[model samples]
Target: MLSDTDLQAIGLTLRLATTTTLILFVVGTPIAWWLARTRSRWKGPIGAVVALPLVLPPTVLGFYLLVAMGPNGPVGQLTQSLGIGLLPFTFWGLVVASVFYSFPFMVQPVQNAFEAMGERPLEAAATLRASPLDRFFTVAVPLSLPGFATAGILTFAHTVGEFGVVLMIGGNIPGVTRVASVQIYDYVEALEYGNAHRLAAVLLVFSFLVLLALYSWRPDLRKT
Candidate 1:
């Protein structure tokens, strides 16, 4: 039996995950493509930066982001200059943090997919007089569907499970920033074990299902 607050937290979690996944797809695709194809010396550094969150503590990342979005911080000053106010403690702030936290989950799989593609298909497309952009759209993306699916699933699931980062920046504001993980934390802190268990169980089952679907999916073998 979920309380109204718990239900709201679930809904907010879904919304946050959905938003973060979509943003990651748009932002990570070109970055992954470049990482897969670039031979530049900067590739290693860029890739390392992209993968930093995987190794860095969430609290550390969240701390920096919190400062960066604070009223006097650079990001905060810039946004204020642009009249958008401070980002921390807002939905958009959560979206930005989630995107950073889940970035590697989205990029790595797609980058691997691109690397596995080899040069043969692109060369074939070249021979057909297909422009670089055309080949990327018509050839590269179609073949990379599996990677995209994996990236999207991983990003969404990771975002849904986020806690430390969201907590550090989002500040538990009910429908605004009180996500399921944070709500569960509050429940436990208040000795409300039943509520905590209910939410935790839902998240556990949801995450398992998402991963199961990702593993079972066979994009290459599917009849399109």
Candidate 2:
């Protein structure tokens, strides 16, 4: 029988990953759209910053986030003044950490898909009386579906596996911040290798299935 604590950790992980992916979709799409189409001088710097999490150590990111979300920090003080506590050590904090850590996963694929599309489809759409918004919704977004799927899956999976950042920001409060990755860490620390293996295998299988779907269906989804 699965312990209640384990079940709670799994549920929280899924919730955190789902919320993080949703936020990434909302936030990353516009940035990716701009990056793909814009010729601005700042594009390189902006892209690099977006991809920072991919290259930077997770502990470094977590350290920065910890400071930023601490009581006296900008984010913390600002939110506290508004009658809302800083979200650190809570579910929302986990979401924020996941989004920040998984940002490149969300952005790069969408950008690639958009770049792959080039300008022809939107140009043709404009010729057919489609407005900018219309062109994006009708033409650009459809062409970018595969990328979005890939990005969403990657972001969710990455978020699920996050450990250092969640530990820094969320502090392992069971049923609140005790996500599966952290739970696995606890099991390993307690020398329960069997439990850790079980959890890790589950995550591995789930990620493999998601990537398989993405890679297999991607070719079929290409624009004609």
Candidate 3:
């Protein structure tokens, strides 16, 4: 049996994951496309930067994000100057952090898909007088559906599982920053093993289902 607080945390976690995944698709698409298609000397460097979070400790990333978004930090100062206030410890702050944390999960799969697509379809479209933009939207995007699906699933799952980064920046404010992982941490810390088990089990089941769906999906069918 889940408590009201547990439900709230679950809702907030879903909201965070959804928002982060959507933003990643919008932001990561072009970046992935470029990484897949470009031959520039900067490609390796840019891809490395995009993949940094995978190797870096979540606490390390979260610490820098906290500092950068603090009232005295550059981002905080800029926001204040713009009359937008600080972003730390807010719902939107969580979104930002989640996006950073889950970026590679979204980008890498899509980039790989693009690379696997080779040059044939684009060339065929070009021969038909289709412009670069047209080919990208009509051909490249449609063919990359599998990658997009994988990216979206991975991003959402990763965001839902976030603990260290969210904890470091979010500060456990119920209905604001108190996500499922944080809530479970609280439950355990208070010796509330039952509640912790309930929430953890829910997360485990949910994550398993998401990955199962992703793996079972047939990308080839999307083409037909």
Candidate 4:
């Protein structure tokens, strides 16, 4: 049976994932839109930066983020100047780290969806004198619902499974930053294999169910 601390970890993990996915939905959409539609010279560079986490080791990214958000770092200085204090080892810190770590997961699918949409719909909307924003809200977004769903599901799941980045940025503070994965780690470290197995099984079953539903619900929407 899972203890109260274990339950807290699970709840915290869900909250973090939910918040991260929501942020990604809002922030990533415009980026994906630009990536799919623009022919700007800076596109390649920006895209590469967004995709960096896909290849960069989690610890490496977390290390740099920690440095950047440390007291001596510019981000830390700026936050302090603004009276926001440091970000590391807090729930919001986990949010910031998770956002970066899971960004590409959200953006890539939406970008692909927009690309697959082709130019015809946008062109048609323009022919009707629809402004860019209006057309995006009306035509492009409505048509790309599947893409958004894919992005949301993937981002949520990815954030839930995150360990290294969250551990580095948020530490193992219970209720504050001890998410499900971190909770599982603590169980194993304490030789509490029963607890570890229980927690791990929950995560495993969840991941499997999420993927199964995502894949089976709409096979034609996005390829796995």
Stretches off by above 4 angstroms in model 3 are: 219-224
Q: Kindly report the root-mean-square deviation of model 3 from the true structure over all alpha carbons.
A: 1.3
For model 1, give the 10-residue run with minimal summed lDDT: 215-224
Clashing pairs in 3: none
The models' CA-based lDDT, in order, is 0.94, 0.89, 0.93, 0.93
Residue-level error in angstroms, candidate 4, position 70: 0.6
What tens digits encode model 1's per-residue C-alpha lDDT throughout 1-224?
Answer: 88899999999999999999999999999999999999999999999999999999999999999999999799999989999999999999999999999999999999998999989999999999999999999999998888899899999999999999999999899999999999999989999899899999999999999988987775543435
Worst 10 residues of 3 by lDDT: 215-224
Write candidate 4's Cα lDDT for 205-224 as tens digits: 99999999789876775443
**Candidate 3 overall lDDT versus native:** 0.93
Give lDDT tens digits, candidate 3, residues 95-141: 99899999999999999989999999999999999999999999999
lDDT of 4 at 19: 99
In candidate 4, which residue ranges exceed 4 Å CA deviation? 220-224
Minimum summed lDDT over a 10-residue window in model 2 is located at 215-224
Candidate number that wins on TM-score, 1 or 2: 1
Taking the candidates one at a time, how many backbone clashes does each contain?
Answer: 0, 0, 0, 0
Q: Please give me the total number of clashing residue pairs in predicted model 3.
A: 0
Per-residue lDDT for 129 in model 2?
99
Task: Give model 3's TM-score versus the native structure.
Answer: 0.97
